[model samples]
Target chain A: MRDAVRVWVLPAGAGPDELARYRAVLDPAERARAARLAADGLRDRFTVAHGALRVPGGRATGASPAALTWRRGRYGKPALTGPWRGLHTSLSYSGDLVAVALSEGRPVGVDIQHVVPGGDPVSASARFFHPREARHVAAGCDQAVRARRFVRLWARKEAAVKAAGGRLWPNLGMPVDRADVVECADPAGRHRLADVVAPQGCAVAVALAGQEPYAVECRTDLGDFR
Target chain B: MLEHDVPTRDQVVERLTVLLTRMLRPDAPVTEQTQLMDELGLSSSLGLELLLALEDELEIQIDVEELDEDRMATLADLADYITANSTAR
Candidate 1:
């Protein structure tokens, strides 16, 4: 059977009661990381995101949420430590949205960005993006137009980096052809990219390390598990 | 490739401090001795982000051959590499 790339999406604005419930699922280190966040909102989001990570990870690895050992990848992406080492996963969030991606044998990455009407993708493109990408983003006639383009590229690039086990800075200078269905910068490692179906004002993308068609599921409501 | 004149230690540090403070940790104090891995919490990804920011600010391309975990151990070390490799401007 072709392993499907499973995904989970949750809101970052769960109330204190909901937050407390999800917080129970996180391990000691994750709990401590949540505590280190200066803001309650940030803490709440971290709890939800990490808590979501545990659900599928637990199901696949047969490890308890608290007992699942997470080892950091070269770029700080987390992986299952020990015998369940073949599994791959990635997580990301922006504003009130959070996302998690999982695959059995291939590395996977997911990114989500909350799009704003007046945000300046043009300036951002000029500043840090590759010259080729910067021009493409800048080609948009207005702020609203460019903002959409910005989130699309940002989400795609971030997903690519996570899939490759690399970092954003080095790849920022590398051009990503938005026109291509799947942009693979590394010849040795092939990848596939697709945009996720999300709510209004949100741009999301998932990148997987194989060319095989993946069964993509957009789960907007995971609060029932809590 | 031709050799380029290295920047003064103080110049590199000054530029790096500005870039780091703005990019990575505006709240935290940055200095030559600030540990990139421990203190600043620069994972390989964040380190690459900082290098890109540095490259953009300094208008110089960092050679892949010059970068390694050992050489980028601290803010000072990164500054030294930037100074040594950047072209004269």
Candidate 2:
């Protein structure tokens, strides 16, 4: 009956050496998963450095980070296996920051972006953005205008799709612009989509399914792991 | 799908400007051409929030298709679209 979403913000400042040190602490299973992620060009050092902090924040009770096994679907999205059932989680990295969100009984997705002035949000939108979203970005006259709106919309859509447990392909037929709040009715049931604004310079969002009051807990500290 | 009477061009612009000012950070100065994201730092979710707010305040339904990038690039564009399309009921 507790439906609160817990969000943990991990400092991104950990360097390569620091990440390696963290990796040494991981149990065999987590180390293997970290290796797989690294094989995919997801830096092991960064993932370990950040993932180490996020894994514990879940407060998975008797669970340990290294004991958790991860499985992925065709889209390369990762999920924890074994004892970690019914709990949804997501991870995002931006610069020196790694963010993770946890929700029980609902899929969760999170994204963070550092706003850089005069970035080409329009071009980025066109490549990965939906037609409607692309058109929306195109409306902006300058890079700065387009980029800001582009990233915001991008993060929202990505988080929604991620929460739904698959890429947004055939489902794109649905008009995203019409719904202020969207619910993804997967075979597993309904998932709620919501957005959260991180401290300025950062944008974040969460998707939760089921009938539960939405609550978010965010922290900028990673000192708990040390 | 909007049900309220169409607002005047100036009225729409004024109202939208006020909303933008409030939603965006105090330091961010929104202009007629200010892009919702770049200038105002609004994400897509916030954009939807703005859209919903406008719909609620204006008592009109804004078709998602109508709110394309070109029409939503500036406050002037959004205001114009609202004024031109709002119902006259």
Candidate 3:
């Protein structure tokens, strides 16, 4: 079978009952990690529900969650450690939404941002955005125009650096202004990255360094799994 | 070969002042002695952005190593370096 990258987008309404169904599949340590996150209030039922959705697709082998260890590089970027060498995965959460990215042979990163009209575009652009990007935002002629452009740029750059598998500083050398749709050639190989727009003025970007065209599956029904 | 006059130091400084004022939103004049970080609070990311802008605007390749804090102390200093280096090329 050909290895394929899968992206899963969980809807805003996913809840606890949906998460309970996957408990049986999780190894003891994975369960423990979920419990810890829940206790700390860093996550709740919805977080666990989406995390469960990612479990089977992670391609994790063995009986223990410890088998799914991750190694951290210099800048604290994390990667899976094991026989799953080239496989890449990442998960992101905002408000009630959760998104995950998986690829067979290259690092993958994904980001989603909800557009807030009349937001502070300049400050956001100044902190995480490229200089030319800030100029683009500033030239938008009005508030709504600037806010939309700012979120698009923010999502694109964050996803790109995450897939680059290093510190954000190293990727600074790459031209983010020309990054609208990039096909980056790195030491590992070439990879494609593109942005996706979600309904309700949301911006999403996904980065994949694999052979196939990227596909995104948006799931609004976690109850079906239950 | 046709001769093209190199950009004068004053011209380079003038362009850089506008770029810096627009990007950094600083009120004071950008001078040779004005420290970029101390005066304008140009973070590392912004410094990289300035380098990229200089590269694209002037069509010059800036060595990353040359942009250390000491060399990039002021707007005029950066403009001077970019003009000198690009003209030499």
Among these predictions, the greatest DockQ belongs to 1
Note each model's CA RMSD in angstroms: 4.8, 14.8, 12.0
* Error of model 1, residue A59, in angstroms: 3.0
TM-score of model 2, chain A? Answer: 0.73
Instruction: Please give each candidate's TM-score.
Output: 0.74, 0.57, 0.56
Candidate 3 residue pairs in clash (backbone atoms < 3 Å)? none
Task: Between candidates 2 and 3, name the one with more favorable lDDT.
Answer: 2
Any idea what lDDT model 1 has?
A: 0.71
Runs with alpha carbons beyond 4 Å of true place in candidate 3? A1-4, A22-42, A58-67, A169-177, A180-191, A210-226, B1-89
Top-down DockQ ranking: 1, 3, 2
Q: How good is the docking of model 1, by CAPRI class?
A: incorrect
What residue runs in model 1 are displaced by over 4 Å at the alpha carbon? A116-120, A126-132, A173-175, A178-187, B1-89
Candidate with better DockQ, 1 vs 2:
1
> Which digits, one per residue and each the tens of the lDDT, describe model 2 over residues A38-69?
12224443455446544553356456554556
Better of 2 and 3 by TM-score: 2
- Whole-model Cα lDDT per candidate? 0.71, 0.59, 0.57
Q: What share of the reference contacts survives in each candidate? A: 0.00, 0.00, 0.00
